[model samples]
Target: MSTTPTPAQEPAAQEPTTQERLAWMGRNSKKLILALVAMVIAAIVVTFSFSLFSSSSANPGNMVGTGTMAIENSKEGIAILTVDDMLPGDAATGTVEVTNVGDAAGDFQLASSDLVDTPATPPLSSVLNLVITDGATEVYNGPLASAGTIDLGTWQPDAKHTFTFTVTFAETAGNEYQDSQTTVDFTWDATQSTS
Candidate 1:
């Protein structure tokens, strides 16, 4: 009669059951587990890449040392030559041994210093001629006061060299040098050799 007997009223909708809600959550949880597994796999790969490219080294035997430079003479501080009663035309010769007394090779040199005159008037050193020789090589040949630095070449550790010093009273010296006397010191210098 009325319309077509209004369609049977549909049953009221019901709230989701606990089991159905749990089933929905379980489906989403599976997707979440898969994403977490992917993240863990990515982290492992990054760690291995860093380990493969890393490098390291060590040197336990490395060492260092230092060397020394020094020299000595057989006479040390003693005089190489001395005379008291020297006169005109008189000559004296003395020999000394020089050595390199260090752990390294060095360049040796000889020079005169600390000259003293007794009378200080006649200047005895001017009239005294000095000649120094090392084997066959003449190291210096000049007046005692005019001798310059003389190079003795390179010497190795523990090496020894003989030197001869000869002083001659010039025959041309006159009576003014009768009471005049002279004294001097011999100096040895050493420097480390480059070669």
Candidate 2:
């Protein structure tokens, strides 16, 4: 008898048709594109989060901080008390002016603190020498508003507001420190002596 190959003895598998191959590729390509889009969105979210978390100490949207002290000279503006000298039982008159040296709207608290007693003398309460005056009349007395607020509104190039806080020395406990330039050696800066 002659030996013949049976149909069951054919090759393991047949090659796919062009249409079938295209369908397979299309299915996988959709999944790949979807994954890439998700990854991109996630990266964008992380970048924004990091930027928000790492920022400097600054006010936002045209808000300025009141950090300038009138004691020092400033071109952007200044607050100064004109006085012959800062001493106890002595009167030094000056006005607190809010001048906008820069073209920025700013706010500040302008006030003097209570007289701090130092040197622990024979039991003496140091009095803050001050009297707030509105024009010629004395509106308020005692330390000239320990804490006063000044709203500059809009600086508008060059402009300022002047408010007077005239004060007189009440009573102080310490030594005389009189000098053109001298450091008041006590709990607060006061007259040690006229040098």
Candidate 3:
């Protein structure tokens, strides 16, 4: 008797449909994307950790110290110049000593604030003349209100410099400035020299 072949013995193979192919692709793509994300996150964490460790190691034993450079004025803080019952052509003179009390050499500059008049109507600084001298050497000569910054050169540690200031009132000043008084503030700034 002859035996018939079973369905399992068939040689022809059936191809996958479009839906099956699409489902397989979807599953594989999800696994691939998840693997890529995990790898990226791990790389970022490693890079950040490396940067933190390297930066901390680069500046090992770095320390900072606190110090200061100070300058002292002869007047302590402010210098008062008073001219009472003054007439035209009257003049006054004052002296100040500037010393570097710090441990470093420094360059100094002298500046003056704008002249302030008691009576705003008549400006007394207009007719006032100011002259600054360092040991007979002229440092500045002009109107008090118009004076700008003046370089006083450099001073070594524990060095001192004396300055003389002369104020004069113009003879051309009129009665408008009779009761008007003007005041000026002086500033001394010292900066550490590079050399």
Candidate 4:
């Protein structure tokens, strides 16, 4: 009879005991915690990334703008005072209406420039006297040569003032001032008020 080789039998598997299960679990606990931490971080990142698409808009009436400062006068291009063939003790008076036409308040001022005297010697401007008044308040009372810049005080928007200008040929003027004439240009200036 021919003898056949018999195959080796495999051993039967056995269930793990309670102590072995506990030990296995303790070893794998760190991996479980790490996996849970990673999952939570991913969730947080996704939540924050969704916020990037959020947006908002302002109201239609919400607007920004700027203010303007401007000034004007009634007698824009007219002469305030004129006297022809003026003699000693002669005077010429004129009235002008100055107004703050701008929407903002400002400081008002009066200045004189371009004084032309026919004869430099015994200049007529030296002997000519100027008296400026606003109501009862005298703004200036001096010779034309000494009148530099006069402050008319602060003015509000649309405010008006009537200024009286009286120019007199000094009575003391002698023959030296005869036939000598003086001309000056007056300027009205306005600057935005600080307050």
RMSD of each: 5.7, 16.1, 12.8, 10.2
**Candidate 3 lDDT, 65-117, residue by residue in tens:** 75557888888676736677878999998898889888888888988886688
lDDT of predicted model 3: 0.85
Look at candidate 4 and tell me the lDDT of residue 91.
93
TM-score of each: 0.75, 0.31, 0.64, 0.70
Greater TM-score among 1 and 3 belongs to 1
Determine which window of 10 residues in candidate 3 has minimal summed lDDT.
52-61
Worst 10 residues of 1 by lDDT: 1-10
Q: lDDT-based ranking, best first? A: 1, 4, 3, 2
Q: Tell me the whole-model lDDT of each prediction, alpha carbons only.
A: 0.90, 0.45, 0.85, 0.88
Clashing pairs in 2: 76-101, 175-192, 176-192, 176-193, 177-191, 177-192, 177-193, 178-193, 178-194, 178-195
Candidate 1 deviant stretches above 4 angstroms: 1-41, 60-64
How many clashes does each candidate structure show, in the order listed? 0, 10, 0, 0
In the range 1-195, model 1's lDDT, one tens digit per residue, is 566666788899999999998998898998989999999999999999889989989889888988888777889989999887888899999999988989999999898888887788779999999999997789899999888688889999999889999999999999988888888988999999998
Give one digit per residue, the lDDT tens place, for model 4 in 1-195.
998989999999889999999999899999989999999999999998998799998778877885656656567788888889999898999888888888888899999888988888879999889999977789999999888899998999888888899999989889998888898988989888998
lDDT of 2 by residue, 16-42 (tens): 999999999898998989899999999
Q: Compare candidates 3 and 4 on lDDT and give the better one.
A: 4
- Clash number for model 1? 0
Query: If ranked by TM-score, best first, what sequence of candidates would result?
Result: 1, 4, 3, 2
